[model samples]
Target chain A: MPTSFPPPTGDAEAEDTLSTLGEFGLIARLNAGRAQPAGTLLGPGDDAAVVAAPDERVVACTDVLVEGVHFRLDWSAPDQVGRKAAAANLADIAAMGAVPTALLVGLACSRDTPVETLTALVDGLWAEAGVVGVGVVGGDVAASPTLVLSVTALGTLEGRAPVTRAGARPGDVLAICGRVGWSAAGLAVLARGFRSPVAVVGAHRVPDPPYAAGPQAAKAGATSMIDISDGLIADLGHVARASGVLLDVRSRAFDVPARLVDVGAALGVDPLQWVLTGGEDHALAATFSGPLPEGWTEIGTVRAGDPAVLVDGRPYEGPPAGWDHFTR
Target chain B: MPTSFPPPTGDAEAEDTLSTLGEFGLIARLNAGRAQPAGTLLGPGDDAAVVAAPDERVVACTDVLVEGVHFRLDWSAPDQVGRKAAAANLADIAAMGAVPTALLVGLACSRDTPVETLTALVDGLWAEAGVVGVGVVGGDVAASPTLVLSVTALGTLEGRAPVTRAGARPGDVLAICGRVGWSAAGLAVLARGFRSPVAVVGAHRVPDPPYAAGPQAAKAGATSMIDISDGLIADLGHVARASGVLLDVRSRAFDVPARLVDVGAALGVDPLQWVLTGGEDHALAATFSGPLPEGWTEIGTVRAGDPAVLVDGRPYEGPPAGWDHFTR
Candidate 1:
């Protein structure tokens, strides 16, 4: 079983590098003693993992997190990095309005990387997957010059049509479930050496995606949905482009919570901009023609217009540029 | 769509780095003109892809290829590297006795990586997937200091039970359906810079695993099976340990083909060692309790004993400690 969070800053077991354990030993150690998921027909140690697809169709996606660009070893714990990697991919599966069932984590790191770090990463993966009531089905490990996590998630739709981004129509209300820009705020906090706001730092380390909101929104007749991983405006632009509709955000609609407001003020940055352009919250943003879902809050409106995102009746020209891995 | 291979060593388009085009633009360009596979219910451009799972069961596996460790950019063309990466994972699906259906690729590379290199890699991926009658389904891209490709392949069992390594029993005939050590020999030739035998070099670049032989062996009621990814003895040892049987190879049984012998002679390397201990052949090795499958050639026999592998009635100790990333 994955060990519980033992102080992220602790480095008691960093002396054991992977070269000592070798490839098979390291893989066995990572998955040893862990309980397999119920839906796994065949688990690790096989040629491939056989996962039970309850439905006839499967939903799948992949995401890669690089070492320095995606997360710095100095800034985030190995456990947090593992959790964030799994969370990012899990959120994508959720945005498809499907229930996640399996994960295949691929790790590439320097051979000198401490085995304890890898173990902690797997522990974090197990913890996050445990929240979804599943487990890591398969994985790959390799030696590289840097650390990289490429995670692929598998889910089932339970006999429902997927809520794709191109489904949004005119006159649909755009609402969001879960907090936005908290992660970006957390990044700022970590940068400025302000450790008081524990929530912000935690958000930056491990995003708390509203896991239940995806299926809930789908059941509530949402026409289109997306998770805010690349900021509200940037993700909304994807919907706008894909659906060929304009999304107009009403600034008054979002009541900036005190957590964000307080953090932004301390750093001399606008928290609303984080809400608008900050990504990585993994919050669900959806367009609905009917009444909004219980967890969703109205944030914008959709109309038949040139494919674009409008903030308060004008194009958004904010300071927070969207997060694109290459550009960043 | 993935562009056609212009030339193996062409550098005309290598000047356009990934940073210039950015993430979204690069992704859009990579996938813009591509055609989706028939089984892809929802292709790329979505948060997640929906693929038809015809059997209500999915066989999944992943493999990560890191630059320098897995391949050298200077040694291989971008296309060959991509194909090799995809082939490694696809071979796993074949080893499961399943049909390859979908792929999710995650790529991380330096910002200075040429756009053409990325395109050629995708081209290689597509070319190999086409060999299996499918195409890329979903993927993620990131920026890092080195190039990495993490590929996850999904396959369907078509209602057949998985042929695991733990099924071989006493008195089973051990046979293999694909050529072994060709890749290892090819690697030797490449290392020595002997370019005359193009076939040997190509095998090292992209392995041609016997994809059909897997399901064939399963259908033929092979009690145990494995792909020779980490060398014959190493992989056989896995089967021996799992199945609790001793596998003894008859020296005279294997007819080392002329091509392998010719190549070995040219490089002054023992081809038999490559055949015995070389890795990355991806050949299907199986133990059949019934009549041997038509294409499979008898090489060894399985006996109920302490789990071990022997050559010509004796324990075999040879060079080429199988490819383990951290150790290598």
Candidate 2:
């Protein structure tokens, strides 16, 4: 029984395009060598995938990445784009104090797209999911004028209560794990048409989200947590409003990386400003009343005031107010 | 505390574009007035949503619908398009013999898209989800050149084993639980630019999947199940190959509806061909070794032979070979 569509024949170059390979062929190619994790009871090929949700609950989130809006093919490889798309949603799951279990991708691209590009992009999705021992369980593909990746990640909380953005209290201390402003610096470098600073440019390409730190924070009794996708200040604003408390960050709390400092000097931009206002780093920010978890740096505190984010006791002045899809 | 983005003000007409309302505002509008089901532990407004997976396993799948590819705004209302998109993924869940729990949508569209259209589309998503007592728990929206809706549905098996496509035996009876080829008939009329025959046209716009019949068939000891999204013969091919048995459909078994026959006669086309090869009505086709479930009509028989779908024991001869996104 031949379950797959007929294999492509004739000239190899003509068969390289998605249109030549057809939808089923592309799907078969993308799923050819992928490995499923233990949590994946059933992987791709089925109508729906079944994944283990040991905690009796599933934490799920979706993040959509448009080609021009989120990344450029010239700046990042297809694999990198795939990784970033997966990271965005995986980080969201982690922000809820959950361990990611599976990812489902929905890709819409032009018929002229190269089959190689699609395969590499899926390879990146697999690589990132492999980081947490998860699998790309299922997805759908369609033909569109532009490339769009919509990734949905599912996770389990391991029996712990989810640490939401609305749990911060007046006396809680603010802490963060993972880098900030690196992606912003990377974007600035890319905007200047210089790709020499591989560090920041790579950061902009694929975020290294602290996935394990989420469960660690929850186990350590953190009250509130959020993924820093929209800069330190803008994302904290969400927490501030959600928790009904003012969050105040210290100016000197961050130890900006030397690479960013050197790049800031060369570019005539303040690295600290990027740390305070840049986004897309996918860092974890949480509030704790007890001792901070290892690897988390204390940077601010929650206070009794109007729901707002403050820098060094007052609102910080900045033009980079974080990424807003339509506004930008 | 203002958890929502600021309410729209100024001229109502000016505030109607997605650009004017912004991403957060549009999300708020889509989420406003919608009720969450009991299975939703955490709905939108956070990094992720938590849904109850009471059976310790979750069934998940993704389906993408493009504006021009899967639908046309002029042909179908935004809400109808939304309902169809949600129905596509929800039917996949039901086909797995699972009860739908939640949905996460990923929408990418031009910035100038109408706010009303987006809201209406979401309203349709909510309307369809409400039918099954589920919620649109979380999703993401982004700016793109075209509109694309990627919906991910999660479900629970409720202690029942999933009726997969590979479980059929040689002597199983093939049955169907819903209309087939009606959407194809509607599409034929729409392609010819005639909107009259409202019944078939409406079916093309929004599918009425027998959601309960999936679980009902599973409970009746059905060996295999599949959603007929690609067409009766084409989808049956999947079951035939997966089950390693030949599926032979009896042409006399189906009583083609008079509406399709009238339309087919008017168009000088065979209505039975549409019933055999037309897709997108989202009917359930399953193989049973035991007595058929209520509402199921036996249409074929599974036999020991090379894996293939046969119309009266021979290969189906037609041009409407089911829907394939890339090839078509």
Candidate 3:
């Protein structure tokens, strides 16, 4: 039924922590009283799960979130971490112009973590995948020194050719279909200790990716597509290098939402830096040789030059770098 | 070509370590000179990988290995750990009577890990998956306080219904195909510091699951099957409980390979205990209404009784207990 679980139920928290529940016990609890979608031919508790594939081909991707690096428990709830993990992986499937069908999640955490916290995280995982009409078919739980959430998303292209990053060419127009700096603005509000304007703060914890825009752009003949995960300019740099062409984008063309502007004023920071240099919103950024897709804002044009991302006739040097797991 | 990689080639280990290469640089090294199989519609270096789902349905499973809990880096090399990780996942697919196709790996390690060690792990991952004629389509790497490897395996049923644990009937016969206590014996030798016989130690480091036997059992009309991961008795108890019947077996029926018996004698450990209580050998145990499949050794009989596992008509108790990740 795609139900959601908040913080932790009193009954759940009253139970012994994960160590007392045991691995198998916790897994059984996860499947208890839950119904899977029809696409899940086989659910958890088996050696492997069988998920129906609507196409002869499946798109697969994996992402990992590490404790202290990706999220801090004080900054976000367990559910928010679970949601962001699922959202990031699902966005990759969407970036490939496919609909996500199922997710296989693996979690490793300290034995002291409460069972209620784990259940809340799992609830968040299902709730996020449910938003895209997919299911969590299988997963593994293990003991670790820190909490780690790893997600693998499987999707189908529905007979459409996969839109690769190399398909963009000169004269194609670059467009975006979702917000630019919401999560970054949200992060700033959280990092700078601002309590008001809960929207950005909440978004920093769980990103609302444009799930439908991926397939919609694919249907409308997107030459190349990518999710703005590592900032707009930084992610566009990947397409530019892969397509072997320069991408010239207008700074003003990016829709800087009012929330971001308001947050910037509160923190005395430049909102444009968040718009151009921030990431993790999972917005759809694609290049099209024809008319822009519905609801997409034309942001730039592909040019016949060196492989790079240029903003307003020059290379962007706002943040000095985008997010890198190791470097960060 | 499914070729094996020899330990750290000069070209691979000569590159800068992960600290200097960064995350993207490390990924670029992983994809530097590797060519994917034909079934991989699109390989790594993109948002997600596209794999051929020939049956229009995919069987998925996941397993996680945490250092200090699953393996000790001091006892097992990085390559062995990687091979064991891949082999265990591949075994789950085989247990479902399916052919594994693609694997997505997610790794989290401390920042100080050497690039050479990481590449060796990856090489071993490919070498093991290559044994089953599949490729690693995608993976994620992150900095973690402790090393954790999580693998998700995708397989195809090939028009056969999955051989689940619930299909065992009262009149069915039970059989096993592969070594039963090799890994447990290997662990004993390693813990006791035995040096002469290296076979058990090697087995402990990297399991050799009989991948072909699973499909063969399914083809020969075997009723059900499961991989011997959580000890023979513990795993059989699951099948017995699930099928609502008793599984009675003769202790002598189990083939205690000579190496295990010899190792037990030297350590004063009961060899039968290892055979009945050991796990992680990745051997296949199945039930059949007809004659046993080729190469299968008849070991037990399915009976109409309370759900339990009995050895020689009595309840069997051996090792202190099977592995419980949380408890451990």
Candidate 4:
């Protein structure tokens, strides 16, 4: 339905480029006929938007995605890029044990960018927000040499306390819900100029974050929670340091997906390495002292020791491991 | 005091670049020793930040600034750019009759960028947010070819209704608070490579938006409100269209400051034109049916007619007006 929307400004031929549609016209086109959730007090087209925060607090986070650095037009469609950008921030809010209320985006692109591309990107943003019953409440667009998207997600805790990284206690079980290594395998396939494995490639393009499992984990007595933006080992390193406990992941605990195993064999790399170190899956990773949530799988335990992450009781020994934006 | 903060890493010489400091290290440097406000329930280093929303609703907005598009490093210091970016979004919140509570920033830049530059920019963001007693709650950094800043501001309405741009009615008086055209004049001087006349040039670097006046105007029964980011006429055009009313500005209403007058005379242009059409001063424009609030100057009136902005009851005749990121 979004794709069927009319061209910006009604003059189909003249609305080819952003410059031709103009900034305000483009905004109107993007905002036209979108339905906001009940939490949206005021939607786009104003200086700011108002969203309900019934719990007396709002959870917020921001994530930046750059063209070529985060995604390439040749590898993923603009809509896919938009979905990935929104998911990155939305997952952060969910990791805080909150239900997303709204999203705000800031986009920078060249003047010559096609109007269709921009509209499709916004369509993706809307589609993702719709999945969680939220809306793209506000945003701004500007001209820049490289395309960049910065998204901020707001959510409500619904009266529960936030599950921070510092709360994990020794003896808590570490668990994860959602796909992990699929994105890394997808990235590998893309880099090698092969795209037949649509599952991995699609995983790389748009993550399927478990939106409800975050609050479900919190309600299930999660001591600490985090979203896997970096690889499992590296991100758990943060939890270990913050909670002042040792986190040990048992490699045998994982039941590797058959597709990833096949891809790994074809590429001559251990699939477990990708499972341990792959990032950007936006998977929900948390520690629980009580029973694991319905969708969660226990893979490790927290122990008393100096802060550090271990695989099978020792330092991980495969792949480059973890992502560092600047250094990488 | 912020300037006195030490280098990104303990080793001053080796930690000069972002690549050397690394993403986590750079984040640590930017967040080190900064005191978060009381409303910040959870600050940075978490998956998401939780901020107090006592009013049961949050007002939010986002704005983007690109390296060569919004500000130039050669023309403005990194700190100034940060302040400008923060101010741009903060003003939007204020225009909604809300008090800013927190800011979330997303930054993208080259790996070779100096750590000092990035930290200084964060200092400016802190400095600006500090003015309204808020904190930089959460953000992300990524690698890109050019520096791009995306700021999302959240605010509370304190149980008051948002004074949107659609409520203006016939016979309402239009008023303005804070400086206008000063930044435009400063831009003119900067374009000519004359950085002197510190007053105007400084205005270009950092806007002094009337933060308090927004709520004040609302309390005084403002019917409609907006902030002047684009030139007055251009921004008012939005209010006019949204409110479905004619807005007429009186030429003699403004008492142009002597500084701006002198600058205009020197540059061989009309200072009044700058006051009418210049932008980025972050001045508040509101319509009221009652008495004007403190610091507010009556400038025009709303009339019954089709949506349009008129200067002296006619179309504006002056230099190219307003800003469009792509077209201009």
| Model 1 segments more than 4 A misplaced | A1-14, B1-14
lDDT of 3 at B210: 94
lDDT of 4 by residue, B127-225 (tens): 999999998999998899989999999999999999999999999999999999999999999999999799999999999999999999989999999
Candidate 4 docking DockQ: 0.85
User: lDDT per model, in order?
Assistant: 0.87, 0.92, 0.86, 0.91
Write candidate 1's Cα lDDT for B159-192 as tens digits.
Answer: 8999889999999999998878888888888788
Which digits, one per residue and each the tens of the lDDT, describe model 2 over residues A162-237?
A: 9999999999999999999999999999999999689999999999999999999999999999999989998998
What DockQ does model 3 achieve? 0.75
Off by over 4 Å in 4: A1-15, B1-15
Question: Worst 10-residue stretch by lDDT in candidate 2 chain B?
Answer: B1-10
Candidate 2 Cα errors over 4 Å, as ranges? A1-15, B1-10
TM-score of each: 0.95, 0.97, 0.95, 0.96
Error of 2 at A164 (Å): 0.6
Candidate 3 lDDT over B1-328, as tens digits, reads: 1122333345545545555567878888766776678888899978999988788988899999999988988788999898988988999999989999898899898776888788878887888899898988998998899899999988888888988888899999999998888888888888887644789888889899999998999988888788888788888887888788899988889767788888889989988888887888899989999988789999999999999999999887665545678865
Cα TM-score of candidate 4:
0.96
Docking model 2 quality class: high
Q: Can you give the lDDT of residue A186 in candidate 3?
A: 85
Instruction: Tell me the deviation in Å of residue A307 in model 3.
Output: 1.0
Q: Is candidate 2 or candidate 4 better by DockQ?
A: 2
lDDT tens per residue, model 2, B189-226: 99999997999999999999999998999999889999
**Which of the two, 2 or 3, has more lDDT?**
2
Worst 10 residues of 3 chain A by lDDT: A1-10
